[model samples]
Target: MRIRDTGDLWWKNAVIYCLDVETFMDWDDDGIGDFGGLVQRIDHLADLGVTCLWLMPFYPTADLDDGYDIKDFLGVDPRLGDVSDFVELIRTARDRGIRVIADLVVNHTSDQHPWFKAARRSKDSPYRDFYVWRADEPPPTHDEVMFPDEEQGIWTYDEQAGEWYRHRFYRHQPDLNTANPQVRDAIAKSIGYWMQLGLSGFRVDAVPYFVSGTADDHADGLDDPHDLLRELRGFLGRRRGDAILMGEVNVPYEEQRRYFGVETRTGDEDDVQGPVGQELTLQLDFNAMQYLFLSLARQDVAPLVDTLRARPAIPRDTQWATFLRSHDELTLDRLTDEERQEIFAAFGPEPHMQIFDRGLRRRLPPMLDGDPRRLRNAYSLLFALPGTPVLFYGEEIGMGENLDVPGRLSVRTPMQWTAERNAGFSRAQPRRLVAPPPDGGYAPEHVNVADQRRDPDSMYTFMQMLIRRYRECPELGWGEVEILEQPEPSVLAMRSTWQDASMVTLHNIGPEATTVTLELDDIPADTRLVDLLQNGEQVIGKDGKVEVTLDSYGYRWLRISRPESRRLL
Candidate 1:
């Protein structure tokens, strides 16, 4: 039993909710969501039990790449309101105990950015080196192009600069030269500026591309990239002791661990104080998410269990950020072709439903065929997993995607607050919206917060229940996780224990109802498994064995209890 309720580790038991302001709500009826709209909707998030709000980029942009191609890192887009509106949003969100974090997209900048504009003017410009450039014509690195349909290679020739610049993403956005001390300082300044303006932290975008150097970069750029992360972490700590940097690093588990800060030994190898993570505080768990999909496709728990066991241990303070769908596509690049095919066949059977040849552009509701039981079961499993659960906007209401929207924008449609015109997202005409609200059975008419709020059995209500249960059971986030042994392959039974508190969660992903047997040898002679979801309780007799029946796609959270057990003050 261990107690870990310290001030610096709030993220250990926090629930993160991600949203894009452009599509979240349009308060001014200008066909775009603004900070004013977000401020008005703070109560909705508070009601949903979100501890942290991970906001997508709202900085001044060229309107390319869905705000990722940032033109000014410090200025707010006029259409989305000014600095005053942003400050008001932060103040309002904080009033509800919801900390806000915005996107730190330093990996690249829009070509229209002032720095990029000046850099292209002359070779002697100081900003010229701020971006990666090669004077000589580089060979075709066709494989490096991120968007195969749009880009032919990673290097795009700049006519004004007479040099080829590198862009790992799109041609309109050029990768920054992080190796340059001045650029690093600029990025740090931007981070500090936002923190001073009330941002709790940042969701670092494209962390790998931001830190790693490429062949076209300067000679010194190839040096250890992790050093930048260490510096950023140190800077963040000095500014705000509790501020966190949640990076988007999509790579293999072995490689991804390095982003959390590698363990280094001092002069004495046997020192009592071991090395700890000194870099990013949290990272998106791409590995477990991919395996989760695989497990769902097979309707077996083996894949998820294997991946969970394979996860490398990180420093106690550092944690994983888990999610089902994000603002972007649901990527499955880590999985093999055969496994990827299985998931595609199960969730994304249509060609239009897939993207990047490695991911799905659709949201979860349509993928699961809008089955209420399975939806609740999967979400329950997500909240029960050993990490901080992150929900994309409208996930609580089970929003669907619009296939008519090209590329990743399919999942970036407007939020449906009601069944009114334009889903009540805006007063403007439907055609003038940022993106049309999804159509079909999953449209606002059928699925919306207004309707769900009235129905007790709706997805929105179920998510609220799941979130309440997750927040109540801190063990799920800060406990020792164990994959309990069970006979049914379709069922996954796991236990999380922290201090004197213990909880066991079981989920059945298959279509058929089944019974699962569990042996709790360490339990007391006359103990009971208290159902946290309801009033029912199951007694574990002297034999230390318990049998529980589960309906198809059913789930349960049970707490180990003894007759003498009592709550502590």
Candidate 2:
């Protein structure tokens, strides 16, 4: 392991784009996305101003759970590419200033994994402890199980071993016995292998259940993954300097803050920026995301305001990964039943789009019915919110989902590059393709990159404009966020301050046009609201208040800089 305090912190100022390799592009005509295709398309991401790429998973697997079920940790999936292709992809991507982070799915492995296969052969096998096994009758802990939609219970009877095994997700994926020293060592070794592969870091999957199980079954006690996370953080730091561990802990803001190393593994224990250990460098802000959709669903902004107000403190080095949608369904579990129902009725009216009883399996464009204004507002809010923003694949061009695909696979369609067959993704026949692209209104012929690139008012261009503005205004990501006091319940207001710069963003969540008055007493009397987009401008009134008029789903981002004499331009 190598340790160095590079202090690069490139992720803090990065625009991250997340995608699955199998769904991005196909280079070999093998009917699947591959490293060669991704390499060929690196310029597209670079042109979009993406500073980092968060890949879902490209490891060898049984093609279950979107590559979360790992068959080999150190090698690349033969379908995607070999080791040389991945290394070349990284090198080429780096040349364009885009760092890559692959998914880390250590919580469980496919039953087809060598260790699991070996362990099932006999209880006396040395690999037996690599996976959790229940000698006695398995406990009834369905309430805490992660995947209630797919799994029945935590234990599965393996006839080969004559014992029951624990699995938090699908039955084929057995939970790894992280409590074992050898198992822990193997996990660490996997990390080292990837680091040596020249990866920047990993996006940790299923963090909450990483340390859960019987006390003897876990190196750390049940339901507490802090120690393992800390160990992983330390290992990352030592093996490859400045590599980050972005965790997927989707709890509310208060509980989610613990993933950033501010809280301890034990009960209510914590140390503020302790020197000894650290946890995840980045955690997805599920609180903001859940409430973002809720606010939109009810056409009310209170849910979002409440979530932002309840935000917890994180270490200065830590950041929250902001996103609109991810690999799985967009879950509204954090909200109340009534609130979730309101959202489901509005966005996911058809029951086919909902999953896990609290999430929507569809993408944003179709959910909003392709209303450009609302989509722009939501995307604007995501970029303007605190922490680093994570853009999902094809979200930039307003890609739609395919409900025909089962489970959460609805959103995992092939990238529509052109209007040609297979959306210019592959030359293989439709039957040989991995997963079909959207059909009907969202089909490649209707909505594709080739069409949007020529249209100035397209979502593709609008996303580019958003990214340009986001990069131009660093305060939105690196500065402090303060919720503004506005009388309009439909309008959400907030201010970001950093160094000598301050920015204010106002978003209207309701369907009706309205005017809002924000109390700007704290702002200097001479400061003016400069529209960063060069579209509109307003001056502070002598009464220490600012009035904003917005359309049904309008949003405004204003920069408050002391101009020449504070006079109106």
Candidate 3:
């Protein structure tokens, strides 16, 4: 799994696994997951076909806003082990074919940081300009503040400095002033420190909030953040030639191209688009996921297909990191309240939806009780989608959301390795769970790695089989996607071909059984189609028409090739 061995070397065919190190493993029984604990799980990740491990922030923090409130960029959070532990985890993961990507929070630092402490002491301090501050007037009020209920505004007044500093997120996490040359240089040096340690890459958090406009204006302005990103990329590129630096630029799809340094029309007056430097390796496809979820809940597959067809063509080297669940909010803001209510009505009170505040919570289901078959169909769609797939920590074992717990902590529960006490996560008492279950009832039988591994029909096994099959066919890894225009709206059909082999993924997502007729006029006359999921259960007519009978939500990947060509080979 050397970086150079892969074609694009980006997350092209990579399967990423997201882990919250603070809550992932607890090796010392202190009720906190540490790097040594993560190092212990390296083999599990490799066995699960994970090529890259994207860890949430593991830096020194105040523990108020999870790990996002960084107190020290150079040091690891003591609760999650020290520098030695991180280095060991990196070496262990790399040896097991896993590239580790850490979270880089450049937008802000914790108020507890030494630099912030020095800046707060005096307005004339050398570190005063490290963060965005205004002495003449209050800081800008961007749109409606992110936490209006919790805070009065985006800027907080400092009595000592007699000025207000900008903060896009929590007030404790003050936004860094990227406009300052010294601040930029210091951040670059911090990145270089990690690069020198042989870490794979980074996931830049809240990249667009690096700079700000006026107090009355919420606009981000025409100046792309690429100037800062490019400077960081250039410095890192010089040191580590092929390492990646993905930005969490969660903007509109049209604005995504700018991250790749491509200038295009933004449909606004006097707002010409400019390039944001950096290869634009990956942009989280929230729009695509939104469209898919909406279509599924409404039972209208046309919109999903149309959205995929209308997607802007990205560079061959670029890729979308697809996921059904991640460490973020589950319900995206793209959907209207009406749509959300409709889904809740149909799905019948999902645990995560109980406290879902305007769609700002992420949680997994405890079990596939309602529609296990439909869940399997969704998994099929995820794996067959045209992007690198990312599996959330407990998704493989059908881990459910404990909505009883507050915030996104419910979704960040420990990995259920066994049905033992604490689900084999920690040796601590049941009441000591960092994210305790709402009702104090553990889902020992329903959600555990040992039980699922022994069950062949488990979601974990299904995912493993799909990944193994995908690896067996290199065409599916890197090939052109040609979606077939099928008459049946509920069926998703696509073809991936390379050289002499062609792979067709057909899925029936509808509630009723359907038969798909595929004309072989375009294909070779002697071509033989082999169903990988259902062995030899296919019928091909002499009139060059292949009829496939699929059960409700059934899917199959057909390996189509000429019989004579296969025999000769």
lDDT (Cα, tens digit) per residue for candidate 1, span 1-569: 23544335889889999999989899999999988888888899999899999999999999889999999998999999999999999999999999999999988999999999999999999998889888898898879877876888889999999999999899999998887888889999998999998888999988887734554554664445688888888988889989999999998888888898857466442221333788888999999999999999999999999999988777788889988889989999899999999999999999999988999999999999989888888999998999989999999999999999999999999989999998888999878899998888988999888999899888888888788888888789888899998778899999998878888899999999999887888897668898887668788868888888899998989988866768421
Candidate 1 versus truth, CA RMSD in Å, comes to 2.2
Clashing pairs in 3: 25-33, 364-401, 365-400, 366-400
How far out, in Å, is residue 396 in model 1?
A: 0.1
Model 2, position 472, has a per-residue lDDT of 71
By lDDT rank, best first, the candidates go 1, 2, 3
Tell me how many residue pairs clash in candidate 2.
2
Q: Give per-residue CA lDDT, model 2, range 398-441, as digits (tens).
A: 99999999989899999999999999999999888889998998
How far in Å is the alpha carbon of 139 misplaced in model 1? 1.5
In candidate 2 the C-alpha lDDT for residue 105 amounts to: 89
List pairs with backbone clashes in candidate 2.
Answer: 2-238, 179-219
Worst 10 residues of 3 by lDDT: 268-277
Top lDDT model = 1
What's the TM-score of each model vs. the native? 0.96, 0.94, 0.89
lDDT computed for candidate 1: 0.88
CA lDDT scores, all candidates in order: 0.88, 0.84, 0.72
Better of 2 and 3 by lDDT: 2
Alpha-carbon runs more than 4 Å astray in model 1: 1-7, 211-222, 264-275
Q: What pairs collide in candidate 1?
A: none
